[model samples]
Target: MRDDSTRNTIIFVVCSLALLLLYQVFILEPAAQRRQAEAARKPAAASNTTAGPVAGTLPGVAAPAQVRVVTRQEAAAASPRVTIDTPALQGSISLKGARFDDLFLKQYRETVDPNSPPVELLRPEGARHAWFAEFGWTGANVPGLPNANTLWTVTQGSTLTPTAPLSLQYVSPAGLTFTRQIAIDARFMFTVTDTVANTGAAPVSLAPYASVQRQGAPAHVGHSQIVHEGAIGWLGDELRLIKYSKWAKDGGMELPSRGGWTGITDMYWLAALIPSQSENVRGAFRVTKAGETNIFEANYVGALRQIPVGKQVTETTRFFAGAKTVPVLKGYEKQFDVPNLNWAVDWGRLRLLTQPIFSFLEFIYRHVGNFGLAILGLTVVVRLLFFPLANKQYESMTKMKKLQPQMEELRARFKEDPAKQQQEIMALYQREKVNPIAGCLPLLLQIPVFFALYKVLSVTIEMRHAPFMGWIKDLSARDPTTIWNLFGLIPWNPASTPLIGQILDTTLHLGVLPLAYGFTMWLTTAMSPPVGDPMQQRIFKLMPLLFMFIMAPFAVGLLIYWTWSNVLTILQQYVIMRRLKVDNPVDQFIARFTGKSRAA
Candidate 1:
């Protein structure tokens, strides 16, 4: 009988572990792979691809035939002139109109990318149409410039057409003239420089202003979201006029509302550089006014800097227009700082820890080439590191399980007096030196790590559309194969279901993995002692079903992690049960620290 009991125990443990490992690899891992694959299939979902110049489209400037790609010096020597045509001042609309027409425009749509780091872009639908022409400079990269900085001068009457050839001419006061060629090769980055020359004798007071009216309804920004300008600031509906950061008595109010444009500062989703005094200020500023036309202006206050007549002062304004990816943005360095990366939790201390975790996950993806294996390896490392703590917990649970009969007797004896029952239980606990909550320590330690990893797996771009084995295509979405149909009547079988029929159907055929997950959780719970009163036990019995429901929609990778962790814990418990001898409370108090069994 003893041998039979041992064999049964071994069988149970092996079956449970096998189920967990299989579910993780077969179901969870594949689910994650599916999610990653779907995301990778979409071009706009890639951060690097989206940030690069939209291939095949340039606003304002027409594509040149037989494009000449040469060094900055060569392009400068061949400088071409681009003329912006201003029509008869019609109605209230400015003659500077920018139109964005490109096939790549679809890449800007809202969707999660597994390859690109996540970022928050706070503009409305105006981004849908590329800026063609406006009164202000377009904020992006300019072609043919060594550094992504250049200004275009509208020769007043020349109409800018898509087919017309354009050129850039840089005229220096020392007669150092340079010309640059431009072309459209499926993608183009044009930077608009606005240098306002102070041709007037007096110091002209100028506060550069630009606005764009929304042709459609406003976009949504959630309540939890906040716009930070060095410090946190709320993004109000109407025009939000914020002053630049300044040096104050109490250190520096990083984002303070100051008078007049004196220094450049970055606000939520926007950056601007203001000159101490405008001579010919050349820089781009994004403005959102009450009207519909979205206008971005760059102005240079030229010769307005308290300069004597005939001594011309030039303030060169530079704008960067291109992709917001790391490489392209790095070219323009300090100028292009777009806040898009989503940190797990916004708390300063937690964010520090969370960011590195995400960075590490990204690194692992590059090396190991599989996120599923990465998660498993990470879990194993964490568990091994905390083995000592886990051991302590398992020993405590073993002792408690052995004393269950004594505990039940104590409850029965004090059944009439609730206070007496509690006192007896405490006394018993003291005698046994057992801590009920000690088992919770391991779980408590793992919660934060688990949550942080969860965030990384959900948001990291590298894991998107990444493959594991088969069937599963995306890690971020629910399992595509569902087991049941409407009213749980028909089995929506993946193998038998036709492709066209499956496409129209919302239900997916349920598979074995989810069922295995549910069964393992139930068995793990069954192997443990009951807690709380009858009501709690009843609720506890429903836990496995509840967990399966909750987890059904989660990425297969997460389910794999959870299932595998449980399996390891079960094995650990089994070892503790066999090796760590627990004294029968009816017999005597055996010293648990020494592992010696004593007789009553």
Candidate 2:
């Protein structure tokens, strides 16, 4: 004769914990190892492909060339350059091939340190990772057509600025004049206008092409599930996101579309080639090998344009090379009609919910000036939104707690027959107007919202390097304070230890925030009805610790949000239990501490 209402809850918690552990050990860890092994095998600066030859070439066409290994500084200085100076960007364009290379984001740094180097988005050819955008004209074996190796003469400005655009000109041996006028905006978009004049006796058929090429894998490849790092683009209204390993395995992808954008995107940075909205274009995400080096290219080529003798044709395209901020992307989507450009943020399947959540969180952050506080405020908002439902669930839980004694009596009376016990229990519940399963509704409703917040926080660059209270410098990263070194008070790094260092760093590096979250979770569990079975109770008792360990690797922002949410829920539950006059652990704890009677 035992009350078993909490038995189901214990079983559910235990099973969920087991499944999470199994998934982590069997799926995530192994995949991470494989990626690590693969990354170790691939060397840097192998090779790359191009979108066009000089000014007009077919998409995915590879030009025969060897890039001498050189330092990034040396490669950037190897040729004459056009300085790109903007509030958001600082770099130099290579005049050698009229390539948008040697670009750095002025707004973002390589690390949290203020003096850290700015994020280098585009590197010059021959550098360790040569990633840049190039635009030119390509004709069918037409002599003197601009090719990848063609050196262009600066016909206009010394620098490409938002106010003063620069123009480069290349005259083909076949008497065709290719002029490229490149202009930058206040933000990331770059407008390139390619004009081809047919000075030859015959008409010249040419195509305008642009490409974003990566000579090698990035030094630090991200294996995060939430962030997309590789070739990503929208083709003819279809969004394509291909991982680097998958792209290499599948060779490449090609699609024909009237208008779309193609590019290589990292978690925060993007380098995309947007074709003219008025012209039909072909988009290709290709990975080819030049000798032992693997080349990755995302490019678009507009339909061929005929420039009759003494006539000229102009093809204007756009390039986006900068941070993939939500506002910037959405602005581009609206202003330029870049199809599905907002999808560049990798909002996942819950974009409907995640987008709004992100916007709201961003709105709060703009006012609060601290992302961590914004997350805390967001948790409060979500709790308030679901407060009524949660109150009903907690009230039901209180009724169940009150019915425990009566249920036990009924179970003991019907101990001889299990079916009778279950029936009597159901009838008693119906008589009391209490439903055991009603308590689960609030949790079920929270799953999606919780996941949406996780996605928003993890993928948004705004959360990157966001600081909370002391020792929590980066909200997007795991807690840096480790108990292994007494939370940095010992003046020693746990990572510097030998042998079991990594293991300790992973499992024993409990931070203050996570500890607080664990305590709150434990308190919440303690306030709930106690389980009857010994094993069930033991498993339930261990859930808080187990969950704390599991969530230790999660981002600090997520932990803060969860911890704040738990506090709010605890307060709500306590208030409900008090109103219901139910015997709750919180009341009992306070009574015992104050030496008062443990009575509601």
Scored by lDDT, the top model is 2
RMSD of each: 15.1, 3.0
Predict model 2's lDDT versus the native.
0.80
Task: Give the least accurate 10-residue stretch of model 2, judged by summed lDDT.
Answer: 47-56
Q: Please report how far candidate 2 places residue 372 from its true position, in Å.
A: 1.9
lDDT of 1 by residue, 155-217 (tens): 332433323333344443422222322222222223333333333344322233222211111
Which residues of candidate 1, in runs, are more than 4 Å off? 1-349, 485-517, 581-600
Q: How good is model 1 by TM-score?
A: 0.51
> Per-residue lDDT tens digits of candidate 2, residues 1-600?
224654576367557755865576447755876777776675452323222221122533346365566778887888888889988889988877788888889988888898999988998877766888888766676777665567889989987789999988988788888899999999999999988888888987778888888876675664566677888988877889998878878877888988888999888889988887767888888887654556788888778888889999998899999988989998998999888887888898998999999899889989989988889888888888888888877887778877778877876788899889888888887898876777777787887897788788778888888888887889998888877888878987777777587668865568888898899999888877765567777877888887787778788998999899999878988887888788777778888899897656
What's model 2's lDDT at 155? 86
